[model samples]
Target: MSTREEILFELGITPRWKLRDVAEIESSEETSSSEDLHKGAISSNASGDWSELKTTIESCDRCKLCESRKKVVVGVGDPAANWLFIGEGPGAEEDERGEPFVGRAGQLLDNMLLAMRLNRRENVYIANVVKCRPPGNRNPEPDEVDACSSFLDQQIDLIAPQVIVLLGKVAAHRVIGGDGTLASYRGVEHRYKNISTVVTYHPAYLLRNQLDKAKAWKDLCFAMDLMDKKIEQRK
Candidate 1:
């Protein structure tokens, strides 16, 4: 009957999706944020003019958000990783740290990956849809996500992660298709260029909401399962 439960119902997924602990997420926010980030999104597979793509995003001005950006967070992960994770964009801490998921959020993300036995140096990759952090850590405007679309697509083609985990609303909307509300979506498999995608709350959200850790744990388990299955398939 809570917001998290409401989201699970909307997604029509049982088990992990129904984590009714709204208070945990409510408490988890450093200040509620979003991406054009992805499951620690990777750019290894991008196609169509890497040179042009780099030039394009490097000088992007399609959205007002571009003017205030510190750096365009393209992505960081093993180019050969078979799994991809995406979130929205950088936060103030991320902007300052210049590393994806480095602050409190990043530390939690590292824990999430640890739950799945994924090491940042291996087995996974990370990125945001829009590299720059929006002013005041606001939701990325659609126009901003659009400007960065080329890089995202290329990253997909380049990395070719068989399994992709969408970490937050911005990443969810980009990789799957939704308004990016955990209150309305999670626990279902969405598709991106024919790859399997799972949605979950952002690490920052988890940090604020300790009670939902178990539910988030379920998501972590599922992700590990999918990755394991994919790894087996390569055999």
Candidate 2:
């Protein structure tokens, strides 16, 4: 298959071909036990702090993805950043490198952040709803999401970001909790633990449908504007 075909396949879009075409596509744990594990862990680890949270993620075996991951992608960028970017999970490349958003999709995300005059190492941090890659790049299951939700919550508490950009369906579904489409989630600032949240297309999705980059840009700008408001409120 060619590069175009591969991308289409990855996105699960059917390809047009000469008698042949194809495309395909495609957590956490908790305290020992809790209804909202991450929520609880966020409070408990508040005192344990960032290092404890990172160590927990790195050594986590709350879910089966841990069995297969080469290295757990904890997160990256400013620990105290005002901007936080959360995606679905680590992809193959991310799993290999033990970092989130470091592949083709990552490059696009970097460009998007640069457009906002931000970079991961400075004013922004990047992470995933799930730390480990789902086998075969598939969407993470509910059990997996539940298992890993606490780690994410802990990360959020530590960073205390002013605005959260939830990229793609999984992040939206996990954080926002709805059956609505991604369109429904966009253009509105929802609240997750009282922090402003904006939903947007994942960079991987933008890689396939370049047209949506405009919409994603709008989402990013909205997030930036919200962050500005949050900063002013603090002052």
Candidate 3:
């Protein structure tokens, strides 16, 4: 049996090739090597504070994306959530809707969350490394991530989640700040802002590579186990 088949067996989810074929996400990246940057001054905000962070993001002009964004997706779900899902940035649909992980990718994510018996509307908080959507949905520029790092840091500090599941390589790099490959980062528990962290394929990537859903499922299980251990340790 193939890895994908094995995972489907383990999860008890039926495999439908036609459905899988229909779910492939088209590449949203534009063919532009131009690094046209917006030269806006970045301002420092109060650390360990939520209001200040939200205000800064709403009015941020530190990166080029701020100029083109329809809305800055700070986050959604419970502020005091024990689980936080962090992604790279907003996509076209997310940008338009002013919410992260909306549309198909979001739907897949919702399914994933459902599979784990967790709901985004409940004890799960979702946010991205960069609040603003990059033009054409490209990877967030390093400077953009840097400018927004403070906000993400503040959010982590504020939420104080037991486990953070990073949703892509970009998120792994932004949170962990290392040169390690995503494969190397997976299955190992890392720390971000002193909170336990796990790395996984982004839902968008999983949409394109359905076989990896099993691995991503493993990562989610790892995160849940870690959170359970933490809760037990608190007793």
Candidate 4:
């Protein structure tokens, strides 16, 4: 199969000609002393400290999510990635695996990353607004998001990514902070911690609404342009 076809097959999506035309895309903390982190004491020096952060998340009880979760999906990928993708929260597969995006949705995400010439293990990082899987894979409550805010914040500081792609409404609401629909947030550049941010449907959503994959592709193109501009500004 052709490279493009292979990607579509992996995504389990059929090629949309317009999307094909735009075929471009775009795509932590550390603990500290446990007490310090639990008390919301983020160490400035803790930026890029993955080990400490992982320890904290594993034992986190900041919200009810920790109560039922099998494992904490701390996040995965390059510590100092240029691209950061944030999602809502972990699901059953992710909770069991202790990693984010390992199910079919994750497979689609991988294909999406591949389309953008990025990879989770490369200069890209993937995380969620909340570390633990919500019971029944439901949307995380505001308090749950509030509980994990500091951890996610520390991750942003540590990664210092030039561009962030919020992979659904929950992430957009948590990161960008407004009562906006996912469509309203798309096609525009938002800022979080001064990092350029783009919003798009989550891979899981895309799987359910295949027709929207074209829209997702367009969002990705916008994100790619944002990333390109950021790179240019650095130069």
Candidate 5:
């Protein structure tokens, strides 16, 4: 069996299905070369310097979230990563640590990255839709998201990842700009700023709904497939 089939078997997804053709993605008019998008994103931002961006995020008071947050989770991992993972927002632990996904959910995410043969220290970068933690880990308000959206956009432009994986409904909604349910977005190809994108359950959600782990694995497999094809195209 092929690697894809093996992964499907291990994940308990019977009768392995074929991934969507890379050609379809290539043919899409919305698709642009990753290099072009990267350049476009950098140019669009007034100050593309990483340090300056972090400083801006640090001093940002566009929303009331800054008042309650202990530290702004600026994001962590390789500055020039190929895989960008975007989560909803920071939780308590993340707020305290000033990093994204450093709690129990973060541990699971690390395992997920290992499964994909990637890691935080390698070709992977992680960030959140909202940098500050909600008062009580609640969903970030729309106004708060609007306040922080440009920073996230700057991060995406700077990283220029080959594929973007949206971790939950909020990220899916924020990046992909849709009101659709998470279920509707999963197992399908999406795009953000002309880059290939995938959606999957958040590790925190998977922790609560253990049964969905298999589905999440499938989503990872799909993302891996997309990454492979993108890499192949670059060759």
Candidate 6:
């Protein structure tokens, strides 16, 4: 505590707060308030209460990425999807369409799903580790990714999919603990809160590399196999 900071603290100025710091403080306050407001003893109510949270994210100013967004790109796919796909974030087509995976990459994904007897929009639900697009399709900044993570958590809670397939290094990094190598992480099963999760190469990566599609296919097959096993075990 410098003399100036001490005095400012007494005056409640926080004059030293940078734009980023001020934004973070405001975000913290808002989160605290929301937690208090949603403090029901029942876990079901807390688990189910995300409509308001989603709306708040739609108009969020918590990060600089929000400034460039055309639409919120909340998420897409069946709310009750047995298989959930988590990716890095929205790409150009996703941003333009306000849904995840709608470009050439998306086409490849569609074909891959169709082969597995799954439909992109009907059978499977898709979300991103992030809800916003990075500028120039670059990777999300760490701070930006952190800021939007709770939204993904909420999506996972609402869906409660039997298996989660994390596509690409980014989603895998968040969902599966590792040294951040897709090669190392893919095809392995991990626990995400409660659901079974596997990491896979993104469809976009498959489109670019082509060869990796074989590997991606294998990962998807593993996910489906596990899903079936779970069902059989339950029965």
lDDT for 159 in candidate 6 is 71
Model 4 clash tally, residue pairs: 3
- Candidate 6 lDDT over residue span 173-231, tens digit each: 77775547898887668899978899888877876786565567667767866776676
Residue 221's lDDT in candidate 2: 60
TM-scores, all candidates, are: 0.74, 0.79, 0.79, 0.84, 0.81, 0.77
> Please, what is the whole-model Cα lDDT of each candidate in the order they appear?
0.67, 0.77, 0.75, 0.79, 0.79, 0.70
In candidate 1, what residue range of length 10 has the lowest lDDT sum?
32-41
Model 2 TM-score, all chains together: 0.79
The clash tally of candidate 2 reads 8
Q: On residues 56-172, what C-alpha lDDT tens digit does candidate 1 reach at each position?
A: 666767777778877766667776666788889988877766567888888667666643445576757787878788999888989888877777888777778878888877788
Task: Give candidate 3's TM-score.
Answer: 0.79
lDDT per residue for candidate 4 within 31-93, as digits (tens), equals 233222112121122255688888987899989887899989999987777788999999999
Model 4 lowest lDDT segment of ten? 34-43
Global lDDT for candidate 6? 0.70
Worst ten-residue run, lDDT, model 5?
37-46
Which RMSD does model 1 reach against the true structure? Answer: 10.4
Clashing pairs in 6: none
* Top TM-score hit: 4
Compared with the true structure, model 4 gives a TM-score of 0.84
Per-residue C-alpha lDDT of model 3 across residues 1-235, encoded as one tens digit per residue: 2233343344334434322221221111131211111000111121366777788888989888989999889888767777789999998888888888997889778777755556688777899999999998899988899989888888887877778899999999998888678898899999976789999999889888877886787787678667657755755
Can you write out model 5's per-residue Cα lDDT over 1-235, one digit (the tens) per residue? 2343343344343344334222332343245554232222221222259999999999999999999999999999877777899999999999998989989889778777754656788767899999999998999999999999999999999988878999999999999987899999999999888888999999899778867867887797788777767665656
Q: Tell me how far the alpha carbon of residue 214 in candidate 3 is from the true structure, in angstroms, after superposition.
A: 0.7
